[model samples]
Target: MSKPSRLWSIVDRRIHPPLLPLTTQDSQRLLDTIKNSFRAQLEKEHGLTDTIQATPSTTATNKVQSISNATTEPPRAFARPTDQHLHSILKNPLFSHQQQLKRQVVPASSVESDKMIFKQAVAKGLMNITRAHGFLLKVAGQKNTEPPVAKIENHGVGTLVLEWLRDSGQHRGLKWFSSSPEFGGLLIRFLLAEGHDELLLIWLDQLMTKEVSLGATGEWGITSMVFRELIKAKTLDPTLDDAYRTFLTGMNMLEGYSLSGKFFSTAWRELCWSTTVLAWKYPKVPAHLFEPFAASKLAKDPRDPRAHELPLAHLGLHHPEKPSVELALEWLRRHSFGYPAKMLLPAGSLEMARCLERLTSFGIDTAQHLLLSNQEEEAKGVMEYVKKITKILREKDHGLLPEAAP
Candidate 1:
């Protein structure tokens, strides 16, 4: 105790006046003074006091209230127009023009909306038949995200147009349908389905003259459907030869303009089938439809001689009694020289041997033709194959052959 008291006395004596503890009120006053000094320095550095003093307090309060309200409230959603409103809008010329312009700029939204509007108009009976037909043509011509065929069929628009055509008469409708290839194909399919033969015939007649272009395969399919219908009709009533002839003329006209080999082959195959049927049913109907195919340049090409096989086989098997076989044989003889033995002979050895024997009976030497064509090895092979099959047949038909002369 003595040492602590002496040390404290010495420290207190070192200062001129000893320190005294302050009251709570004096400490509070000091803290207040320090806070005021700091606030003044900050206001001077940032110029915040002047800004706050210049701003109207009422406006500041209003801005705060507005921000709070914005945060608390939900945003309003866009309202889609009703079908009636869309119909009215579509009917308005100015609105329609704007939509057309929008379509040119941004096709996605405009096309879908236009398609919807068109469907709505048709459903509400707002658009007339002619107007609807024109609209469909315009839509078909555009490059749309949806396929034109799918758009027409899936949307029931094709059905609506079909109904109008049926009610208004197909004469005018055929013109409407023929305005576009898409429509033309749809019209043919509809006509065939409904058995509207008279109108279909008129459509086919018009198709020959019209420059409407269904793509190669599309055109082929349409022709096949029509031919099948005509064949069916002919099979049912053999008096429809005029119908068949009209189709043939139409096909011939198409063939003139078509450059597709597939087109030619498809046409020839169909004609062969149809001609075979006709030959069976009506002997008066000339069996020479294949003559045009045989005469065509396609038949003369040596590289793809197999193209001629189906038509020839059709004629040889179905109309064996007709002169078509003789015509086919003459064609073969002329072209056989260029053909490989595989192409020249039938697929099966037995069939080939019998075919050669038939050629021999016809006084046409196939081996000789091959040799003349510079296919000597192939010619020898044909002769050997024929001898083998003949020996086999003789062994099998021993009784058919005369007893050995003894």
Candidate 2:
């Protein structure tokens, strides 16, 4: 079918000009007009009559006649009904009996705390109170006061306190365009403490991108150092099935290593230098990246003065049930390269006992290889280093003198 032509071939249409951009003066005029219109509307709505014209005249140019009923307007914007105000209004003697007659049974672990406590703590700010109290006790000082009604006993309190702070401390929020910088720092520190290194990275990413004014190196100093040490401590696990598993996962995490360079400073360098280097390349290493450090630093220095520390050499003195022979041998290779020479020496009673156990399980060649690797002088040196760090419980149990336990 043909299109309809009966529609008078259409009348001529005119295109309106595009809306003109307002200049500053035009904008001021418009704003003034809007304000006056709003005020007139309010007056009309509130029964305050005025002789405003069809074309509204500027109040600055003319005075309109006011209505006989018009009076001074009362102030606007009274106090908002906040929780405290609501409590004052709703609470009377009525709720006190209800609130107290049945006390809220708070849980020992938030694992046990119900949805209502979580919501109330969130809404009423009591959760923040408990979190801040817990943080203040744990991080702020050694002498911590109990939460108003903390029910934790023994290590239960410390463990639960740490858990609560980790989950609740950085209840992410912003009062303005920027986040709470104070909360960010505390959140990062608490996450690192709880071994939540991944969470720390996420927090840093938010701070860096959202708030440029926050000093990157200022509040972040201790947090970065803590991440390095935490990974180092984890690697010392005697049952390391995959030596790099935890570290690699943590480093590859989103926003991970955001503050790594700042963390590698002089104060923490000696204590955590090797650890920091290992953590730096974690999941994305090119394989050869670790070669230099493994060859240079770890090989050169395997002993720490802190007697409680795990020594690579001690881990290398393998029993069948101990660390892998391959790992022990690799560590031993690095040890020899760094140490250069051994100081193996005469036997001590404790050494005799360990030697006997190793000999019984790992055979003579392994012992002799170990004994031969560190000649008497070097063996004695490493054994002494081990003694310096370990409690030597076997020595005490067997009543062996330190001299014979060498």
Candidate 3:
């Protein structure tokens, strides 16, 4: 075999039948054909010209001449890039890869592109329910109040979610809402504020089937807000009664068993206004319902001018049949005030007498403290009541009278 044909011998052994071995002439012919074919293919596929300039050895040339009479084609010149051709090359994957590396140090385009594609996929309903839910949660967690598209886009998504729940009846979304009350509350408020009360009512009824929890701050629960919203519209009270009772039951389960207390610290003014509005409209809500909250820390201190003031005002001003005066007096007894006598004076002569009797039962020292703790006009009124009570008691010769009187 010729010197240039030696490389083809190895290839020939792999391809040829085991029984057939190539002669020197056959090997040289195969070598010439293979080299020319390979060069043509490299130029056609890679746009690279053949760089090798060495001529074939005389033995290889003579072998090629003896093998075939066909003339070999000369190698094409190297390609020069015109503007359009260079533009096309730049658009190819390799050139584009280099361009991308130059533009983005971290290659954020794919990440951003992925985000956009994901959003589009969700918007187009191309994603599965799990993917859709994840996307919705991401959107919900975003700080934006308005939907990314037109204002109606969120409404559409909201409707779609509800419809999905209706079809699947999974209860997964409800569980999510219960677990994430803040996000759930935002969604609910948005729905109500947008006048989607029917939809709000529907979701609320569905949600109420499961136990609802209070928020982190012990403020209004999801059920409570929905219940209150229904109450505000003066619609669906009958439908919401069970839910409201359930909500109140949950409220009573709080550490102090107090809804008023829950709302007082978080939103004192709203509590007062809500109490007034509700009490005025529905005067017959049993006083027992208010009992739990009345005894809470929020209501224990009569010194707190705002504490329990609304419920007291509501009971005293509107629901006189209820134990308004007794609650006020209990408030007084529970709290040691800077001016204890003043709080008693507001409950009228009957309650005032009962409160004094209570203090006196505790002992002369307690009664003396209640009176002596005040100054100004209050002290004068307390002293006179003490004197009158002492004279009456001494006349009756009751052991309740103290030996040392004011």
Best by lDDT: 1
In the order shown, what is each candidate's alpha-carbon RMSD?
A: 28.3, 17.9, 24.9
Once model 2 is optimally superposed onto the true structure by TM-score, how far is the C-alpha of residue 68 displaced, in angstroms? 55
Estimate candidate 1's alpha-carbon lDDT, on a 0 to 1 scale.
Answer: 0.46
lDDT against the true structure, each candidate = 0.46, 0.37, 0.42
lDDT of 2 at 365: 27
Off by over 4 Å in 3: 1-121, 124-173, 207-273, 276-330, 337-406
Question: Which residue pairs does candidate 1 place in steric collision?
Answer: none
Which regions of candidate 2 fall more than 4 Å away from where they truly are?
A: 1-123, 129-201, 204-243, 249-374, 381-406
What is the lDDT for 345 in model 3? 42
In model 1, the Cα lDDT at residue 201 comes to 59
Give me the displacement of residue 47 in model 3, in angstroms. 72
lDDT of 2 by residue, 179-266 (tens): 3333333333334345555554454345444434454545334334444433443343332222334333333431243433333222
The better candidate by lDDT, 1 or 3, is 1
Candidate ranking (TM-score, best to worst): 2, 1, 3
lDDT of 1 by residue, 1-406 (tens): 4465543453454423444354575455454544445555566765545422222456469678755774355553322223234554544432334334434322265445555565445445465545654555554554423232321223334544565555445545244443444445444433444455566656554544443454434444444444443434333334334534644554565567653343334444444444443344544444455344435544322336665563563345343234434444455455443332332332344645544444333222445545666878866765665465445444434443332321
1 or 3, which is superior by TM-score?
1
